[model samples]
Target: MNPTKNSKRKTGRVFDPDATFLSNHPRLSIMILLFLYTVFLIVPSLLYTLFVTPIFYATHLYLLHIINFFSVAILWSIIVPLVLGLPNKREFIEYAKDIKIARIKPVLRSIGLGIITAFITLTCMLFANFLSSLLTGGQVQFVPQLLIHPGTTNIYTSLLLGIWEEVAFRGVMLVLILKIRSKRFSIISNGLLFGAFHSVNILSGFLGAILFGVEYNREHFIPVLFQIVYTAMLGTFLAYMFVKTKMLLPCIIAHYLIDALNTLVILNTEQLNWAYFCFMTFVGIGFLPMIINIPLVRSFSFWFPEPDDEIIPFFDTFLVRKQRLKQYKSDIRSA
Candidate 1:
């Protein structure tokens, strides 16, 4: 044997030494798992709120509160971890140890990005509103119900929902998809899915979704803190962070801050001046930078290197090797 070839073989480590259990077609598995999980998590929660909670609570508000708590507990504690095979508490703690919180630059960059992204998001909304008005041939009337409802309670609720949604969609789903496809593919796919998920809103959901997709795709800065702050910008940033960092804590914190801020804004409309509204509108349009530059960025392609391909499938490979090793050991024992 050639000495160089022998040395190279000796230097190489075993792939997926832990023998983690993963699917061969990981992307398909993840999509299927997510769909099934959503059905299982949502149906029961909805039924409980509609049929069971209402019996006791009576009012829609009270019933909604009950459902919220129930969904949180079931989804966070039971469903997410068990069904999805998500990181356990112990594993999360270990992962946190590896994370260096001192890397605050990304977080700061994310704050900037958030502000710009928010501006762009607002701009899109205004643009959409204008388009909607032109199509209708009338001035768009602002419904007081839309404005007045969901006070402090709504803000807190939105924060919680934002965090959970980010963790599940971006953290779990996006990360899982990255295990099978390219990082770019994972980000865009997750972003589109995240955006589509928001279509239920009817008013700003589509625009919001597209913006969120963009945020997920751009992962140059620190994935953890930066992504979370970005999430604060439009509620979709944390989802983006989840995909980039594959961590939950920062995403939750960023989500909480953004929601809390929105809640404050929503609750204090009387205090807001025309300038504030104008500023928000301007910021919403900030996403245009990313939108226009995306093609150029893809063509340049420096942030993500090709060598990361093997590492991209880390989780999937671990699972397959683990299963194979177990089977091999069993066979040996039997022989």
Candidate 2:
């Protein structure tokens, strides 16, 4: 029996479907746009920071600081979003439909997940720091800074870094790549990209990025809120916000809060205790709700009926036949 002539079986799902590509080529158009925009914004700003800023700062440090601050804000709030389509309002609202607070339960549930995620993240970081110390012959350092100091260059730098990174990795890269691939593939690819992008910070940043990717894929709401608790925790949070809220605004806000807190804490304190351990433990306990909800997430797959045992004509567009079991039941009830 010819497979194409068979009336019952459904067509094979597209792995890397032709429709996935915007153009008839290997490179996705959006990826190209992202690369170009990154170069255009980053190169000139770096040049100004290294070369031009020095000339002015040699004469007046205060003026130099002001210029750098404004430069960062402009880059984050204006330049990046304009160049890349981020924080799509329509997409954000649609994704938000999945989230609703009928009672306090959902909110509490999300908060619990946030807590668990925070604990796991801190535990991982501690282990990573210990390993690094053993390998590098240096004192292991794992501190959490909780606030940004007023009138400091570090604040601006952190802000710009957070904003640009969220825009690039979550808003642009993840969205564009996912548009061309399956959800699972896109999630994994985005996770890898998230981790690789932080290579400059070595193992600590890399590990952090991976966790962020995992949390983002698991639950989209609490991650954003969780990110506001710490700057180092921003990656996963922002990514989740991008996925769930589909808006860059929440991401930007989350990133800002995290970085601002870090800047404040680092400037005032010389050392931080392992209260991070306790914090993570508390958060990990909170993630219990999501752990319980896993079965529910899986159960959604069985709601659809099996496809009919007949070959269907291709209508130029791929369309899955709607399962009419509920409607059929309603009609029978009426009769």
The top-ranked prediction according to TM-score is 1
Q: Model 2 over residues 49-127: C-alpha lDDT tens digits?
A: 4565444635654444455455544543454344322322222222122111111223333344334333434344444
| lDDT, candidates in the order shown | 0.43, 0.40
Model 2: how far is 204 from its true place, Å? 20
The TM-score between candidate 1 and the true structure equals 0.50
Clashes of each: 18, 19
- Poorest lDDT segment (10 consecutive residues) of candidate 2: 94-103
lDDT, model 1, position 12:
16
Compared with the true structure, what per-residue lDDT tens digits does model 1 show for residues 19-137?
Answer: 22333344554666556545644555456544544335344454455565566656644554455334222233222222212122234343444344344444454554455445444
Instruction: Give the Å error, residue 243, model 2.
Output: 4.2
